[model samples]
Target: MNNWELLEIRESLLRDLAEFIEDNYYGTPAPHEYRRHELDVRLGKKLKFSSSYPQMTIRQRRASDLLLQVGLCGATEYALGTIEDEDQLKHGRERLVKMKGDLADLMRDYDNCLSEEERKLLLRQAKNNSNREESLKDSERDSLLKLVIGMAVGAYCYNPAALKNDAVSDITKDLEELGISISDDTVRKYLIQAAAKFPQARKA
Candidate 1:
């Protein structure tokens, strides 16, 4: 396949992974956060990379980043499941097995689309990125959890009083459905924090 076709396959895989995580793990990043736009002038430059022997285009870099995120989310789900719930743990393990196979196939196809030298360069870069991600896994996992909590808070911001009453259970239930195993007390804590930051939400 050509480079664009490979990119499309990567994009499709990323989307599938995101959907699976949102359905069975926790949540995925907001769609708008990943979309490229003409107004996003900085994104183009941020995604471009150059070297003396090999280079990565903006689209290729984006695919690589998406692949990394997909891997991170899958790993995080497995880690969370080990501590959170037995069902989740089982699901995490199954998903990871499938994901490994899918990723391996994608990498093979991606390598086929590149020259030998480019393949080596990309492999080296991917390894370095993976190593860096491993070092930051804890912080990244925390951030992901926080993002989910923040989303939960924002979802109920319009009805702050509900967060204190039966609404708190509703919020927790909703989060649980999204694969986020948050407690009512933790939900309340986040509500309070959100209220403190945006006092108007309390009035709402």
Candidate 2:
């Protein structure tokens, strides 16, 4: 398949996995957090097999390939969406759990499979990826908070108690339009924090 076709396949797989996770494992206050942790451990193993040993059977190779794409898509989503740092850290830790197992299996199966330097390199790479993901998630949350507070401030300037009564309907609507899901409680928390931090900004 061409590059475009490959990309299409990958994107399709990621979308299906995301839908399955959300639909089956969605919670009221928090959706997909638990489900994603489970899936990451399960599918990350499949993805790693496909990535590390593409020469395995064709079916195994294909499955792993698709899973790796899904994992990358998930990491990218964490970067763009407002998933909390704790949630991201949880996911990262789950990934490390699988990685530890996979590394052990690799060493057992093949002596000198990865040299000492190479082993260190691989561990560093994995640790760096986890750190980067957590950082990106944090950045996404902070940016969303700033945006919510900025919008709330503008609204409060126009009409005091704009967010107090409705509590960020406009923010939620805007996020929905952007295909970003965030809890109302999170928005309200940011609103309160902003108001408290900048009490002077509030009009009499």
Candidate 3:
């Protein structure tokens, strides 16, 4: 009914959506459709809960329930393994490169439009925003590359004694082509970590 109550419910819904995405996407094995069915059932239970947030009006309840349903579908599609993981990696890498180029152009345009004093202030703000963007992009890039490394390591771990050395070259070359600054040694380290993690999962 009140703004705070609405805001609180929205935040809770967002956290729930994110949890559904992460748990279903990475934690569950295929076929993901089964996990999606389970998610819908769990979401139904959550919606029935009468929390401290003032009782939602009929319109508000309908909107919130619809949002949950739509969010689940969108998350499922985003995390869907319809394509090979390698293909998804290439797509994500390309998107980041395009985003960087777009940001560069935007900064240039913004700089051209400002007065000298305003430019200085805006530049400071831009730099701060840029740092935040870089941090987030770095994190996302690391996650995607880890998946790449996992694929290679999974193959090697399939039969460790017969492991081929070219896995490093494979991942390193792809990363370099995508403008990732990591070294071959770093890639090797990531592969080693993946190897360790995969076996532990298998044992469990």
Candidate 4:
């Protein structure tokens, strides 16, 4: 099966298993560690954190947990999907959309922060201050960057593979779906550069 399909199958099984544990094992005169271990084994993803963002802390296992809490509280109509009650999918979609909006907002800020004159000045400064800015700009890829900026953004936002594979997949996937058209590899390379800058900034 494809990765997404495999994910869905695994998710369905894990969901059923978790529910079984919660209902039958929790406070049911039975040990719970085995159930927890089974669930953990089912969820084989190991968490790798990034010091750069230092912002996103996923408290729940998945969006479903948050959706379940909302259901318990009668928070919104969203918790009721077509399947009687399980708005987790809806919540996941909303969460994805919200993340996309956030990335767009950030990109807008980046654009607003840098005026044409400032860009020229910065490019000039970079050329003067850096060791190989000119040579780097002379590359074929450098020329393509001017043509590919929007494509890059679209691709970055759409391809979750580029970001989620790292610590910042949420933004990356949302961005990919948001119509950014750059390649996933480009996004990863840039994100890595940004992460590299983070450690250097702290040192400075």
lDDT of 2 by residue, 10-59 (tens): 34344434522335433343333224434544664654544554445433
Tell me the tens digit of each residue's lDDT in model 1 across 35-139.
221112222233333342135543365545446534443344425423546776677777777766665665665455556776565456556655654575666
Report the lDDT tens digits of candidate 3 across residue range 62-143: 4345444433433343333234477775786565556445434533443344458754554455566556545756567567
TM-score-best of 1 and 3: 1
Worst 10 residues of 3 by lDDT: 25-34
**What TM-score would each prediction reach against the true structure?**
0.29, 0.29, 0.25, 0.19
Residue by residue across 1-204, what tens digits does model 4's lDDT show?
222322232333344335323454323232122233333332322211223323322322332232232222222222222123346656755665664454344334433544588546545544453444235644554445433333433443323223133323344455556654433333544554444433222211
Worst-scoring 10-residue span by lDDT in model 2: 1-10
User: Which stretches of model 1 miss by more than 4 angstroms?
Assistant: 1-83, 126-204
Position 115, candidate 2: lDDT = 53
Candidate 2 backbone collisions, by pair: none
Say which prediction, candidate 1 or candidate 4, comes out ahead on lDDT: 1
Model 4 regions lying over 4 Å from their true place:
1-165, 200-204
Superposed on all Cα atoms, the candidates' RMSDs to the truth, in angstroms, are 15.6, 13.0, 16.0, 20.8
For each candidate, the alpha-carbon lDDT, in order, equals 0.47, 0.48, 0.46, 0.36
